[model samples]
Target: MKAMSKWNKSVALLTALILVLGVFAAGCGGNEESDAIKIGVNYELSGNVATYGTSCKNGIMLAFEEINKNDGVLGKQIEGVVQDNKSQNREARNVAEKLVSEGVVAVIGPATTGNVQAEEPVLTKAKIPLLATAATAPEVTYDEKTKKVRDYVFRVCIIDPDQSQVMANYIFDELKLKTGSILVDKGNDYSVGLGKTFKEYFTAKGGKIVAEEGFVDTDTAFKPQLTSISSKKPDFIYIPAYYNQVGLIIKQARELGVNLPIMGADGWDSPKLVDLATADSLNKCYFTNHYSVEDPAERIQNFVKAYQEKYDSTPDAFAALGYDAGYLMAEAIKQAGSPDPEKIQQAIADIKGFEGVTGKLSYDEKHNPIKEVSIIEMANGKQKLIKKMLPEH
Candidate 1:
């Protein structure tokens, strides 16, 4: 055998280097497979809707703690990568992009529909699944432009149509209210969606919309709108907005002698609503929520007790939704038998009926949660569960 030339030696050295690098990469991939599963938590930790985000974040944390304590899912711990989006649409998109870059298999999205929508494109392009905490607008799961379901997006909360129809039905058929007014934040997608659906369902049932007013989210005064609505003598008024604005609107409406029963969707679930609207002003005010602490179900009762014990406060609907999302994600991972995002998505889509603190959650074709709407009445600075309405579907 003859000795190899310098050029051949250089080629052999290069080939050996490539083989070594390949082995190193393969080892790293194997190590990662055995490590903790990464789940991203993108929330509005500080912004206009901080209350919702904070409550939801707490619930997610608690669920993870319980899961980790039990040795996590699929024999690997869950590593929740939490980030604050400041409740801004652009920031939400940025956070999602960051989570994707970090190699998260799935993400818990912001509590509001607009924020969730902002994050959807980023996650979808990355092929990562997102479980939205409370984004209930129908478009969150079903993309209007595509005329198809958003494959990467899922929400654990009842959609606007479901909650709005529940409230509309409660007022028209159950409460026997024939006419009502609507006040909505024109800029907020959530408010607009709920308002539109409530009107559609109420009118279809032979109920009349006596008045409708659109307000900007920054507006402080609702008396002008309330006065116009009061003059119409509507049996009830629907205000689809956040807790702060809804609270002030209720307080001002009551002060203006608009004694009509004021109803809203889940946006009215914050504890600060009592402080903002005043307990007396909340009389006859009701809202459709995800869950109520007053529920008698064993799961709800257990969650309420655990939440109060852990956080020293009762868990709201947002919290319940977040907690359910965490467990749901774990269940998906367990069912998938792998941390692959596509498998996780399929596992979640395959969920038939999942029982949680909120209710039995199944997904509609739109990937929207199929759960009962809890009508909560606000009275004397406390929330009371008035009724639970099952969806027609």
Candidate 2:
């Protein structure tokens, strides 16, 4: 009886030991964490700027799909935890908090400067890196007043000054358009800042700003400003605003018989630009962009082909930058040799010559991509790559 009782106790002990070991194994695995690395994709997915967000999301999805189909980073798949900012500041902050809660290693996008800035406090406090895909404002990665780089912030696009100054260089030195007019949106920092930079650079290069007109973002009627600009007879008009208003402005300017080359920044890269302005009206329109589908380089062409095959549309500068953001994160993860966020952040800061569809770039001290700008000219609804120029400085 005593021997039989001892055997029963031993069996119960063995069973309990196995159950505890199984629980430990499951805890260590933790489902998705063991199988994939998570990166947050917070962007303006469904809002006034839906075009930019959708394009960016499409590009990010393509990059991760390609990475996973082959060999994923560190033998684990990358999962993008996408959240829409809805083109609102409050929504952006909410998305940032949600991404942090999801335990993402890094976050990408909030494409515009204001939305990007809105999430800064949340992400910075959470110790998660925020990489803006298309936020071109100078303050996105650094504080203007403090004049210091934000430790947890980075970007894959050039800031406003770079694109603005580069376009100014092309206008004054290359295109030889010695006089320019500025039509700026008073409410938008991006538009207003671009005008300031372009004016500064162009005037410094011996060009004159013959007329400057201001309009609020909501104004659809731009004839008054257009008329004022036309009266000055400037060589070109720079409408430093987004596609929504810029499109109407272009159409109105054309109808008003203001026939001159109109220029803008990356905000003009949306497909809807042609639709809003009409193809014919955009003939002499140009904008400084991150990438042009018209680029003939093998790398650029290959990306364009793949994107077209997948999305059934031409990839814009936003898409290119988002695609680069995905690969940039992957590269940093690989270089860090660990999924630890701190190591990954350091690796990203040290990156140089990182190949992107837009341009081969390295992170500058300020974490902006050091890359050339592609000047895109619109002709009858078709985009043509006129020239690629490096920043003057």
Candidate 3:
């Protein structure tokens, strides 16, 4: 009887061991079947534009979560590895090289055009396709005069000429500003591109550029530029740079007794703009953006809800652009049916009207997206929706 009882105990122990091993094998199978694809993201996560960078990172991560939850793209789980560009061009190059070294199939980011330009050669050499979410400089995908395509580089945002023309038309036809002064950031592709395009279209519409003064992005005090602009006594001041400098310039201009309306491009979409430039200083300010929350698009509403749930705040244009770019690349990859960079690039080149949170995107021959641009006006420290400019395609 003692031997029989001992045998029964041994049998039970064997059964338990087999059950544990079976469970372990099952878990391994689950993970193995869910193999992931790595997509790299480079952004200005910690610098002067940290707010925008953080927002973009959040959006991209949120999209990855959703995609993974849905079994990811093309039977593969989506993994995103993000790097901060530190809002510097050289850092952008480093980040791009690191991402390429990591075996990422395609990359999205380094938001500004300057950063994009700095990383372009590396990405081009690596043969990795880069889809910039918010780099609107005309040189993003081509040399404007030559109309030559920069094959490895593409943009999910509208290019500068489209945005610049829209803003010019809005000011001239909508606001009826026949004369204005351009306070541009010297040698900034973003500023120079927008300024040149606006000047051309504004002048073509019989408008006059009364005063033009160049300021560097790092310049803290703009009182002198404001004083110089004040001498021209133009109807408005157009600043084409990021909000960090734009806000300060506007505040200093106001403090220096320059009470003209301030206008800008999409770079002015930061909530910090309102926070930094106080109500009294930022009165009569307007700028262009990718989308307006108040515009009532279901995609925008969904994205905002998801973002609020995750991060407890609304998403800005940069965030929306990042999300769209990530999803767009995933879609292109699935369409290509392989991780080959050439195939993915070809697929992206043929991307059609994809309804994104930012806007409806369909690339033109120049690799520029044709979409609607939002004109937002700041009144009482809030972004008041003014108008939507549709693409003239």
Candidate 4:
């Protein structure tokens, strides 16, 4: 009886030990999954700029798929935690905080300048590297007031000042247009910044700003502003606003008999713009963009082909920039050989000559991409490449 009791006790102890070990192993497995290298995507997926956010998300996912197929970076599978910011600044800040708390090593986007700016402080405070895909504002990465680049911030797209100068130079030198008028959305940081830069560059190049007018984003009736600007009879009208407002402004301007050539910034590069404005109204319009689908370069063609095959749609500038941003982050992670945020930040700063779908990108001291801007023209509701301008810097 004593021997039998001892045997039973031993059996019970062994079973309990085995159960404890099993529970521990399961916990470790869960930890591994929780510790996977994660990249956060904070984007405006369901708001005013939903198209841009969706395109960027699709491109980033495509890149993530490819990276995982190759065993991901640093032997850990990369995962993305995507959150919609709803195109609101307050929501963007909250999204940023939520992503950091969830242990993301890096963040990819909040496609618009305003959203990016809104989330900048949160990510910077957390020391997480943010690679802006489509936010072109110079201040996205640089502080003009402090004359310093935010260490944790970087962008894959050219800044607004560079884009504005490119457009201004094209109008002043290539088209030889002397007098121009500006229509700006005062409520939008992107519109206001680009409009100011274009005005500065254009006037410095001996071009005259015959008239300047401003409107809020909610104001759909641009006819009054267009009529006022039309009375100036400028050679071209520069509308530095998003496609949502720019499309209406263009259509209304054409309706008001202000048929002069319309020029805009990268904000106008959306398929929805075509839906908003007629082809005849958009005929003589041009805008500065990151990549032109009409580019015949082998790299560009390959990217476009792969994107089309995967997404079953044409990739726009935002998509290309998002892809580039993903690849850039992967490269930084690989170079760092660890998912540590500081190491990834250093690796990104040291990146040079990184070939991206948009262009060959390298970050300058200010964390802005050193890339060329493509001038795209609207021809029969399609964006056609007209010229590529390299920054003088």
What is the C-alpha lDDT profile of model 3 across 297-342, one tens digit per residue?
7778888888889988888888888888878988899999987888
Best by TM-score: 2
How does model 4 fare in lDDT?
0.90
TM-score of 3: 0.81
TM-score of each: 0.85, 0.86, 0.81, 0.84
Q: What residue runs in model 1 are displaced by over 4 Å at the alpha carbon?
A: 1-34
Clashes per model (N, Cα, C within 3 A): 0, 0, 0, 0
Q: What lDDT would each prediction earn against the true structure?
A: 0.88, 0.88, 0.85, 0.90
Instruction: Select the stronger candidate by TM-score from 1 and 4.
Output: 1
lDDT of 4 at 223: 89
How do all the candidates rank in terms of TM-score, highest first? Answer: 2, 1, 4, 3
Show where candidate 3 strays beyond 4 Å. 1-34, 46-51, 84-98, 143-147, 216-233, 248-259, 391-393
Model 2 lDDT tens row, 32-104: 3657898999989898988788888888888998898988999998988888899999999999998888688
Q: Per-residue alpha-carbon lDDT of model 4 for 33-143, expressed as tens digits? A: 875798999998998889889999998988888899998988888888789999899999999998898788999999988899999999999999998888876778889
Which pairs in model 1 have colliding backbones?
none
- Whichever of 2 and 4 has more TM-score, that candidate is 2
**For model 1, how does the per-residue alpha-carbon lDDT over 1-393 read when each residue is reduced to its tens digit?**
235587788899999999999779756864775488989999999999898899899899888888989999999999787899999999999999988987889999799888998999999999999999887777888878989999989988887799888998899888999988899999988889889999999999999998999999889987888888888888999987989899899889888877878899877877789999999999998999889988888888888888899999988888888899899999999999999999999999998789888888888788888788899998788999998888776
Candidate 2 collision pairs: none
Q: Which candidate gets the maximum lDDT versus the true structure?
A: 4
Give residue 261's lDDT in candidate 2 (0 to 100).
94
Off by over 4 Å in 4: 1-36, 86-91, 220-224
